[model samples]
Target: MWSDHAPLTIQLTSPLHKPKTMTWRLHENLLSNPQVAQDIQQALTNYFAENLPQDTSPLLTWEAHKCVIRGILISHSSALKKAQEHTIRELTAKIGTLTQAHKRTLDDTLLRELTAAREELARVLRQS
Candidate 1:
């Protein structure tokens, strides 16, 4: 039972056996914008601090960071979209009002021109 050609029974399961993982940290620039930075920090502290898994594996950490970034982008995009929509509505209303005024003025001018032409034709007919 103790053959010289037998394989080793030990199995590797330590961190050393695994490949070096990418470790990431928040950059200093995250603090550059005071207001946004504060919001990010607060959210990070509350969510990342409290909600992250205890494992902290490289893949999980990377995914968590991506989720946070995605959330921030979504929030910013939503706010920007609202502002754009509001500006569009205001411009559309102003344009409509101007167009209506132009149409009315144009109608009045056409009416005056037609009336003058009719008067000229009546005088010509009476002279003949």
Candidate 2:
């Protein structure tokens, strides 16, 4: 009974539960890319050509088609994101180098190049 520390107790009033459902969505920007559009179009055509003659239910075929298209979109979107991130990193480095050069020379040409690079970086960032 000589302990100086106080005892602590914790209690939960209700049981915690995790959400049971997840929603999947396509990135609309991916659709705007011509290569992605062509790939999806080709996938849909192939899917129907191979499966349309089957006796499977229409609902099942539709669901399966959705899964196929989702895979394509996800892959293409991830690749595009990677490329954009690479471009962003390159632009950032170029800007940093140009800033250092401009600081030393104060040349108009370097200033213009730096400005252009900054604008390009901003455009890429906005797309991402």
Candidate 3:
């Protein structure tokens, strides 16, 4: 039976959703490229080896070496990415200036050099 006024009811069985996982995927070539991957791995290993204690207990030395190596790897990776960004920015600025030149523009040699720099940047970005 319905009454003149009735209270409302609400129910929720589940909470709002969010992404299950977040990922930053690098290029397949970055991982699949043996040379680059090997180089990175070898560098990390060398870093650990160099920092490891020569005549000390394994446990403490291993832990310390691992921490240092991890820090170095993270810093190195960030540095590489930053360097790439800087190179690209520099290339872009050079190209923009050349393209926006006045009637009395750059000479042939300067124009060619600018073009070459841009092309080199493109090549590096593609490889990365």
Best by lDDT: 2
Query: Candidate 3 versus the native: TM-score?
Result: 0.48
The candidate with the higher lDDT, 1 or 3, is: 3
Stretches of candidate 2 off by over 4 Å are 1-23, 53-55
TM-score, one value per model: 0.44, 0.76, 0.48
**Which lDDT tens digits does candidate 3 get at residues 14-85?**
666564795544444445556666766886688667656676677877777666545545555666779889
lDDT tens digits by residue: candidate 1, 19-96: 779655444443465766677677777866665677677677767877886577557555655765665566456545
lDDT scores of the candidates, listed in order: 0.62, 0.92, 0.69
lDDT per residue (tens digit) for residues 1-128 in model 2: 69888898987555565657967778888888899999999999999988884678889999999999999998997898899999999999999999999999999999999999999999999987
User: Any idea what lDDT model 2 has?
Assistant: 0.92
TM-score-better candidate, 1 vs 3: 3
Between which residue pairs do clashes occur in model 1? none
The per-residue C-alpha lDDT of model 1 at residue 91 equals 49
Off by over 4 Å in 3: 1-64, 102-107
